[model samples]
Target chain A: MNENNSNTNLSSVVSNRAWRQSAPWIAGAAMAAFGLSRRSKSGLALAAAGGALAYAGWRANTSESDQFLARGSVLLNCSPQEAYQRYRNFEDLPKFMFHLESVTKIGERQYRWVALGPVGIPIQWDAEIVDERENEFISWRSLPGSELTAAGSVRFEKAPSGRGTILTAITHFDHPAGKLGYAVAKLFGKVPNFVMQQDLRRFKALIEAGEIATTEGQPHGPRSLKAAALKLADPDRPLARSAPMSEILKQQRRTA
Target chain B: MKAVCWMGTNKMSVENVPDPKILNPRDAIVRITSTCICGSDLHLYNGLIPTMEQGDIMGHEFMGEVVETGSAVQPEKLKVGDRVVVPFTIACGRCFFCQQKLWSCCENSNPNYWIAEKMMGYSPSGLFGYTHMMGGYAGGQAQYARVPFADVGPLKIPQGIPDDKVVFLSDIFPTGYFGAVNCDIKRGDTVAIWGCGPVGQFAIRSAFMLGAERVIAIDRFSYRLEMAEQGGAETINYEEVDDVVQTLKDMTANVGPDSCMDAVGMEAHGDNPMYALDRVKQAFKLETDRPIVLRQCIQACRKGGTVSVPGVYSGFADTIPMGAFMNKGLTMKTGQTHMMNFMQPLLQRIEKGEIDPSFVISHRMPIDSAPQMYKTFRDKQDRCTKVVLDPWATATAA
Candidate 1:
């Protein structure tokens, strides 16, 4: 009996879509031909309706390709200038993106990112900012010869209260191996999205919670001792003062 | 000739493989009598850990009799028939890192050079049968194993204690003690541990031994929770509780657990009630999450508290809230277990009968039946907490 029931169940499952699709007319004909039990007929009607709803839901939710969309907003209780100053520097990427090794500015509008990829793989990507509205929005697209290329955008908007700005980011990526890649992405893509969202939140917190350090008085690459001395001697004048080191030392000593 | 080989996930079998000959002067052949599967071994069985070639011999936690010694080995201190427990970590004591007590990062010890480079070039200390990254040394799961760095790695199992009782001292015991030590728990501090797995359970017990005022155990498993309670911990079933952090805060007078240890490593399951998805993201790598617990521990600890992290962690990339950590003024210390450093103190504690870690062992079977036991333990069936495999037992006896 169990074996027969299992066989029937398997057959029904195999024919489920066809049965549901043709159920309305078939049920009406069955009701007319044979006085079917009211309960069984009602049960079949419910099953058909439920299956149709489920299929619709699945179709709406499931994407054919591995495409994922995640949205996150953070209220930074600070000015847009403060947020921009904190985030504009590429060196600050590590504070938010944990896996990022470093971000190097290739050009005024382009940057290169190196990060530890999934399963210990090293991944590198070059990105150019396509759209940039100062302290409002920044959008970037992956350059050629990039591993796991993707497009993403970050937008800052004045909050309703006017006390803070809301930061939002959107990203899209293509899986590595097509359908199989999509399946794997479907399995684990949510993890990266979640991580990215958390990183953004951390970035918001960091920007809002600090006094922006000025680039002034900070060392800019390597400078010779003489160049440093000249800069220190005249803040306003651009290194026009030239004097021998011995003469300068003697003059300073004599004045003392 | 016997060696344990992985057939598949949670499927291990003992087969007559070629006998190991002494390949180096530093090598010593041990006739294994007591060897057990570790919690980390489950990572291999579940296929979460990668780069495991099939037919790898599979035990790291072991104790054995010295059946043969290599030519250059000083046989004076270790002779034939001497019973000893080999640490899960193997270090060439003379290496640069080893001299500084950084055994886990010894240059000569780690077998997986490529993996080491990927994980910041820090070598994962040599371990028995853990994989190529862990030195690929055949583990004690078989009848015989070639033990390298025998003088520095193997500890003579002291007399009078049952082999089963002291077997855990080699790995789980020191690991647990190390957790407590790492947390920097003081004489009167409240500690909370996530996951009552073997290591976590030992962490709780060791916390009490280290003089903790209270130990809160959090887990979904009732049996493990009960074990925690028996070990003098206040149990928190995360499944029954909704707000874990809030509940813990309420319990600890608005301060979170002074010290928190996450024994649940990287292959974390979502079904676990105490599982923090946010924390997992912050502590992505297996090695980093152990330290991530320190982040939460920092939030929960009192001002000026110290967080100790004894859980094993590796990998280069980990996201931690450095701003929060610095703001909280929390101090943390963590590294691989200097098992040799912690052994004498733990042995002294065992000798005084002040601690009984052996009670954590729930199952004992012969080496041949390990495959089934691995499945049971992996699935956490029958509330199996810890399983010890007796290598000398016949297949039928198991």
Candidate 2:
């Protein structure tokens, strides 16, 4: 085997670990297929895709599948201008956006977003609104060399007969080891797509209703035993009224 | 404070937990004086409902003294030290559904909307002490409970009324009233209702109040049937009858009652082939609901008559006899109780001594007895039709 082909195999295996799990068992079958066929890189890629998503015992590295492309839309009982303005202000995002710790406005149409990463690490990116149309649409993307790559657009359309505003948001982001981000957030029962949908709902609530509804810091029974042993982020863990990840861990530690 | 926690399926225990505090701007802390075990709580105890995690608090029918109020709560709406009966359905008063008086369908109160949206297409309002799918708000079966959207869902009780007379304003009374109201009972209308639980008992009396000439109540338990009889219902013990549908038809001059109600929901009991089928399916999680009563209600109703279901159906029900439902051209009305809508009017009814809501209570136990009480209630032991739990009662009170 040549060094180049071996290197290609290594990266291909690492890039799709979710599917390429059971690698050792499947490697034999793949090697057998390779021997039967004329040498072709495309055949190797096909073999990996056909593998099952069984977790490999020797687990390491993150797969690109772990990333998220959150697309959600919600109807708000308000004017398009109100909906657009409520979403346009970056600083108010943490109130509704579950994943964001804070979005600080640094320059005109520019903002810095801090989000939680694996094991208390903070992932941040600077972003600026690229273009905007009053009460209609706005588009934005992350700056170069940021820890995360994100691009998104939001559109507000007035429903017929003056009913309300239809707000739609489409966002795609690739965080470093994004799988860990999903796993951590999911521990609190918030998936990325669900988070985006809830964020849109929260946005609607905040726009039409003055405050978002939640049950944060309520009391429950046998909490200490559950809090100390399994340390499970219980299902009753309230909405993301507080920030995510490290902050939640700190609270759990204090209670534990 | 001592609170009841769900350890697992069929396991409940009272434990010490911190006192509840205001969690939102419209929130209030209620020191629970009276809380009740509902028939629907059996759904949680039997593990028929999903999204119930271990250690989740239980109980929803409760009334208490408001110990603290949040800044956003207007004094005219609610104040500290006020006696209030809390509704189980949480709603933000500004939302579209709340404005339309469909408080149970409020969109914002459920923090876990996405979970519900997946199952229900559109989620309803959050419920206290229910499951996470219903917003996972810690429930009121404790010493002190946090109530969100406080100004909207709680009704102030005048000082003179006893807790037993008014605690049911939280759910069953409104639910039964809604059931009767949905029946659209005209003068001399005849109504047949399935189930004789607390809700069914209230629905029976409410039907009479709404001018129904005759009310037929169906159940297997004689005690429940006797209670239904006391509410002016003609009893049909389903176990003694060979064929309930035919019996109802024969009794009603070969034409069914004008309206039929299903107060017994997802988990129904019967000695029939369909009941066994539904039970087998339910055991395997193949179907989330047992439509035995729903099916009978549809099959037994007169042609073109209305069917009112106040029963709680969580998910998909199999073999619903839709052909009968559609061919008969029946009108059906069903939903969770919009508590804010019926609460105040019913409070006046109770105050007037029109109908005492407390007649449904057959057991009154201290909070610590809740663990054993759950089993007694589920098993229907000790003629336990309904249990009212006193949070402050000492262990040896009995």
Candidate 3:
């Protein structure tokens, strides 16, 4: 899991878009404030650059981009045929993908997806398979009038020297928060490319090692020096995801 | 179980803590019969390495019996009652890095991946009882320690060999051998090494083992220099020398040594103005490491010769003569020892009586006396070179 935390307080699409629209002006005012205080040639140049950025942000917030694409790839230990077969079983995706809820087949070449939003909100969408070549590629796009407008494709190929199969995924979408939503998501480590890479790693672990190794409740990097010192005092005390050894072992066995 | 914990800078205490149990499928519990206070532990003691916690158990080089095993460990490879020396680096064997034999860079071992990625570009393998960025799995300084990825890391020793004879295999011996290996020593090459500490002592012996025709070991301490001499290395007391680099050039007829090794690491000391400058910068947190020895190593090495470093440098180092290094066409090799690669072969070397690594041991004490021994080791008191602790021994006994 990416476990990225957003800094923004506005959760709804309308409020998020409104915040995005105002962000450039806020940055411009801050830059101008500093520039006026300094009152130098470099300061004026910085102020002018900030003004240009503000205007660009204003223009970007006015309309969504035609399409924003995210692409990522991973090398899996499984054969291309096995990898494609497993991917074709869409209902099993939620077993490995933490963000996905369900993919239910509603009709031939059509499906309904219930996915978790930024928070716990449920996002429902309907999509039809635009194209598919068994053991090679698959592509899909959301139907018109759906809550989200997006298209995605995945390609499978044999790795050079027959090391294993290479799985590549491409996703295109138009965000309601406009281009600013991408900026915010990237800042928060929620960039779709990173998420896709992590998801592929998890998938590879499931297909190859049979279990994802974790130190969930164990000691981890400290938030601060003081917290690290406190951890030094009584490290045996569990932190967050403490679980019995047997239960953790059982989880590993289930994956195997 | 009584375990040694780090309280703060230069502060350590043995406390009654719960015994370790298997926490992962590949985990195993080792009842540590012998553990040693490493020279690097002094770095943590002196508060150089960041991310250490207050109650963190703090020993890494250790050996013991496997009293319990997690389900994922194959019974045929590891089992109860096996005497084993566990490497300090934790590796998942299945990771891409592990398959490439870069055990220290294993991708699946370190749990603090995000933090390490932010600091080091990518995470290395998890380490035992070092710091949080290295996975903070409790160390073996206590009566019991949890071993992760047991199938890959721990080397099972034979029944006849004493723990003292084989214990150094976990770190110093392998580290020294790998340091020499990184030098890519050809037969009859001249190798100059900085720092006559334990690792340097081993490096001196290992250079000779690798057929280095001449080895010059440099340090300020008389006892360590004497020990290096005993290991078949020519000694140079830098404190007595007018100019070490000039002296090295004079000794090598101005061509410099074929290969130079910097085992002094981040905490090197010298009276040079640049050393003084680095000291001030390091004190004010402007620089993370003092690179006096490394600078000298680069300046003193022959043009186109290799510089191998086994020193533990935690963060950024300042005042490095990079221009000299580049113009001289020097090749620098350094990494954490891939313990899995060297342990068994080095163990054979120990068993064959070719080298008794125990020459470094100068003090032995109970685990309860670790705090005082830590001070003694750090201060070079009583001519101490290395200190080994018996977890079951009484605190007052020697």
**What interface RMSD do all candidates show, one decimal each?**
27.8, 6.9, 9.7
Give each prediction's DockQ, rounded to 2 decimals: 0.01, 0.27, 0.09
Give candidate 1 misplaced runs (Cα > 4 Å). Answer: A1-256, B270-299, B314-323
In model 2, state the lDDT of residue A13. 27
lDDT of candidate model 2 versus the reference:
0.78
- Backbone clash tally (model 1): 4
* Candidate that would win on lDDT: 2
Is model 2 an incorrect, acceptable, medium or high docking prediction?
A: acceptable
Candidate 1 versus the native: TM-score? Answer: 0.57
Q: Rate the local accuracy (lDDT) of all candidates.
A: 0.63, 0.78, 0.76
Correct interface contacts retained, every candidate: 0.00, 0.60, 0.06
Candidate number achieving the greatest DockQ relative to the actual structure: 2
Give the per-residue lDDT of model 2 (tens digit) for B134-172.
988899889989998888889999999999999999999
How high is the TM-score of chain B in model 3? 0.99
lDDT of 2 at B200: 97
DockQ of 2: 0.27
TM-score of each: 0.57, 0.84, 0.79
Q: For candidate 3, what is the DockQ?
A: 0.09
Best-to-worst TM-score order: 2, 3, 1
User: How does model 3 score by TM-score?
Assistant: 0.79
Q: What is the lDDT ranking, best to worst? A: 2, 3, 1
What CAPRI grade goes to candidate 3?
incorrect
lDDT of 1 by residue, A65-114 (tens): 22333345666666777676677776777766666778889988889977
